[model samples]
Target: MSLFKKTLIKKNYKYKLLDDGISKEDISKAKNVLNSKQITMASQTRKFEETFAKKMGVKHALMVNSGSSANLLAIFAAGNPLRKNKLKKGDEVIIPVLCWSTSLWPLVQFGLKPVFIDIDPNTLNVNEDDLIKKINSRTKCIFLVNVHGNSCDLFKIRKIAKKKKIILIEDNCESLGSKLKNKHLGTFGDFGTFSFFYSHQITSGEGGMIVCNNDNDYEILFALRSHGWLGGTRFYPRRLKSYNYYAKKYPSLDPRYIFVNSGFNLRPTDIQAAIGLNQFKRLNKLILNRKQNRKLIIETLKKDRRWENQFQFIEPSKNINPSWMGLPIIIAKKYKKQKMKFLSYLDAKGIETRPIISGAFTNQPATKLYNLNPTKRKFNSAQSVQELGFLIGLHQNKISKDNLNLIKDSFLNIEKI
Candidate 1:
């Protein structure tokens, strides 16, 4: 066994937000790419994009350096000059308050306005009724964050977006491999984004992908992912239908280097692609392991003699087959004030924890800095979640008895803390 594996085993009782998600095979694949020495966004990235598209039932997938980049690309592509229906400055985008910063930043960065809505703390997703009610003529888009592996009824949202001709972007970064009615969570919107960041469903250290069905959208994204070059990298050529037309239009310029759109250099390296693809192939196993581990942790805690409904766990939404990112727990209202103390206790016990997606993003100081909420509209449910909820690692492996005992003993000490 490797020294790393031996050390990890020796410290198995100490819990973290993530275990070593990268495996030996994943490392070997990356090493092979390094040996090739052509480690830019090349063949491996293209292969991973193709495989991800096919398996996720999408028409196209473009890889980027990170999930934040994926979201940025999706937003910019939606508003690109090449598209017929493009978003413009001041257009409203409805998003849940319980979202990561990137999910909101992309919209703001693209000169669009974000309309924050409340989330259903039970499901840890947007309140579908609230979202539907907020959609007005000024609302041009809906950016949904499938938080921590749970999603709202995407079918209903899709139907509404179609009727309104509004763009939809799904941030499935935290919920990859999850499904609603047998369809993947990220496949329901006009543009879906996924992350392969550490502790996500799969990891490549830092990588992400964006998907779309329209050929035009894909072309726009393809160009935007690079420096808006018509011809992609030498190893992976983008033969857009407009290539010939652009070549003829710009006779003086090199056809292979035609600049066609506003863009960013968000391409993922071949090393990231290699490692991400290796982990992608085993995504189902990883999802299953997380599911089982979550079950074991919760069951172990609930069956203990100290169990007294001191905490509540979020469950999968209706018709949703979740791919859990972590084990999210909400302290009972009676013990709400003790949440931080309990978390510190867990930390001292060698168990790591984090808030549930930055605890109602509007409360973040950055949001105040940007004056995102001038009206001071309160999201009571979201605030409740922020006060009561926190999460711990749900590893991509079975839970050991020692670890389970540690979690149970530490978590049940909420009252004492």
Candidate 2:
């Protein structure tokens, strides 16, 4: 190597967990949106929503401010008066222990009790067997989470949800662009949500989308996404004379200020929509790079001379073709107690990492307040993952050989560390 190149590499080598897929074009689009002065939720947002719905083969797509908001809107829409399979308060929803805080909290916020299920250590998702065991007379919903790029057996879960007449909402923030049996990950549920968070599959900086197959559900979601005003909904701009449809039939009151149902303003800005659309056009390419980087990292580690059976990588569950958001790996059981130190060591060596989706939601203090871990039956799989698991970033661009070797050398030192 040239002296100049060697110096540059020595001074500038750093590895982050992940980065957003942004380019000059995404920035240009955002600038155009700002210049148009329609920076609020308007045409751009609607265009992106339509494009997203078509890509996912869903009947309706509603753009939201964030993934958390998307989940919130979906849960609220499930209880809306206009929705056919509505959820009532105290209805039970099954959720996995290995979950993000917002995914499980949405159920509680919507007045549904969450029945905790354990994740399969091999898949890092809710186990199908455990999920079936948790179901009973009160299981009105299944709020499933598709972890990172991997997923649970969504088809079976969907069939079960259908046969039991239960609502299905997928927290698909991490698994966007993924598919099962030719169907997109989020499309199987009544509502599937996607996040455009900083390091997610694709990014608009911060935004989300909700997709559903029912027009009525879309109408309800549209109403709930705004201020309960059916402003842009089909039921809105009522031609009738009265606010209430039934009252309008009787010609009794003004229809201009009608309040159709409950709602919240979770709309995204046109700027975000413009950027998201730009990034989304290249989603297939981004998925490929992430997959390549993951394979490279594993191969590099295993090929190192100091390598031992120090870690285990989890694959996407059966039938899932994942568009992974990151590389999740678990340390061997014997090294479990040293996980905290090991992660710190990696971080100090310039490789950033994160927990495996806030590990065992039941272990969080928020769940503890409700005594959510009833029966006290130990979640062995969840605990095993918690003590052993962590994730690293997978970039949209191919990783450098030097970066790969650095990670290999650092990880190979796991035993000594």
Candidate 3:
């Protein structure tokens, strides 16, 4: 009776957003950490921080419990009193309306006003012209999200921010190995944050890292990441000028227990660090496989006779070598109304899917509750993406022809849904 029944029964097709991302070596690394009984934030975390920093070409990299926590730390550190160029209350931060929730919340929670900008629908990233137009004297920071492994012209953005003396923090959670003109995406900012959560470029069950090039900023980040306690860094002990001064100044107080600044408990467990470090070693391979799979899937769909321009695939920005997490597809205007039903059909056939980063975060109920968008005005580009966009995973392993065929068949049959 159902149109999908025959295809479903004949092929027995099923696809997932990820294919066992954690390898045996990853599990063994975590297991060894667990067996050591020193499962807290200890040696493994320190080693991972060192290796991550060197690989990213940053002076320091601190591990955190999650990417959300990394964002929280970065925002709070930028506004910290000890920092030379700190953001103050009422400062305006320009952000894309098409970003993750945590990316925007940290700005608001830190007492900064957010000015929303529309995205470039083609690249699915912020439009440089619109972003620059929004900057004014009140603007103190630029909180940019590299949306789905793609970036706006960050080279130009960095130039503008430097001229205006505005702080730049990059949320590189969705893009781990992505590079622009050979330089990593996250390394271009005052602070660059990464996530190693399951289904990302790497998996540690849950983990994240933050990188900075400046010694002073790195020290402040190190202190802020772990309850504001200063002078415990193994990465660069030579740079902590206040370590001896504070120790000798306060003879009565325990020098080890010095609290130089305000902070939160965002340290990751050693097990997570071990797992993340192991997976991180193979990052190049993972990026390559995902890139290949993405190319294969797009080629498969376009080469199919059923292809009638029913959907549009987002391409990387110029000079960007992308490390894709998933294949983002936009339904053509004619198939827009059928989006939900088509997704449901894909699900029934055992194909998993998700909306494009929760669909125009500005339109969410929480945004209304907080009165984030006081104008209640809709962002045209973000709204278009919300209505027409969805993503399917491009796994770390090679996709079989059957899997590719299943995706092509299900996607082309939007009319049936």
* lDDT tens per residue, model 2, 207-299: 999999887787787777877765643322222222355455645434444557788888888899999998888999999999999999999
Tell me, what's the RMSD of every candidate? 4.3, 5.6, 3.7
TM-score per candidate, in order? 0.96, 0.91, 0.94
RMSD of 2: 5.6
Give model 3's TM-score versus the native structure: 0.94
Quick one: ranking by TM-score, best first?
A: 1, 3, 2
Estimate, for each residue in 1-417, the C-alpha lDDT of model 1 and write its tens digit. 231233343444389878878899999999999999988988899899999999999999999999999999999998988899889999999999999999999998999999999999899999777789999999999999999999999999999999999999999999999999999999999999999998899999999999999999999999999899888776774488899999999999989889898878998999999999999999999999999999999899899999999989999999999999998899899988777777777777888778898878889999998899999899998899999999999898787788899999988888888
lDDT of 3 by residue, 1-417 (tens): 363444445433378777778888888998898898888788889889899999988888989999998999899999989899999988999888998899999988988998888899998889777788888999899999888899988898999999989999999999999999988999988999998887888888899999988887877887887778865543322336677887888888777778788988898999999999998889999999999999999998899898899889999998999998788899999988878778778878778777887778889898988899998878898899999999998898899888998898988888778
Order of the predicted models by lDDT, top scorer first: 1, 3, 2
Candidate 2, which segments miss by more than 4 Å at Cα?
Answer: 1-13, 232-257
Worst ten-residue run, lDDT, model 1? 1-10
- For model 2, what is the error of residue 340's alpha carbon versus the real structure, in angstroms, after optimal superposition? 0.8
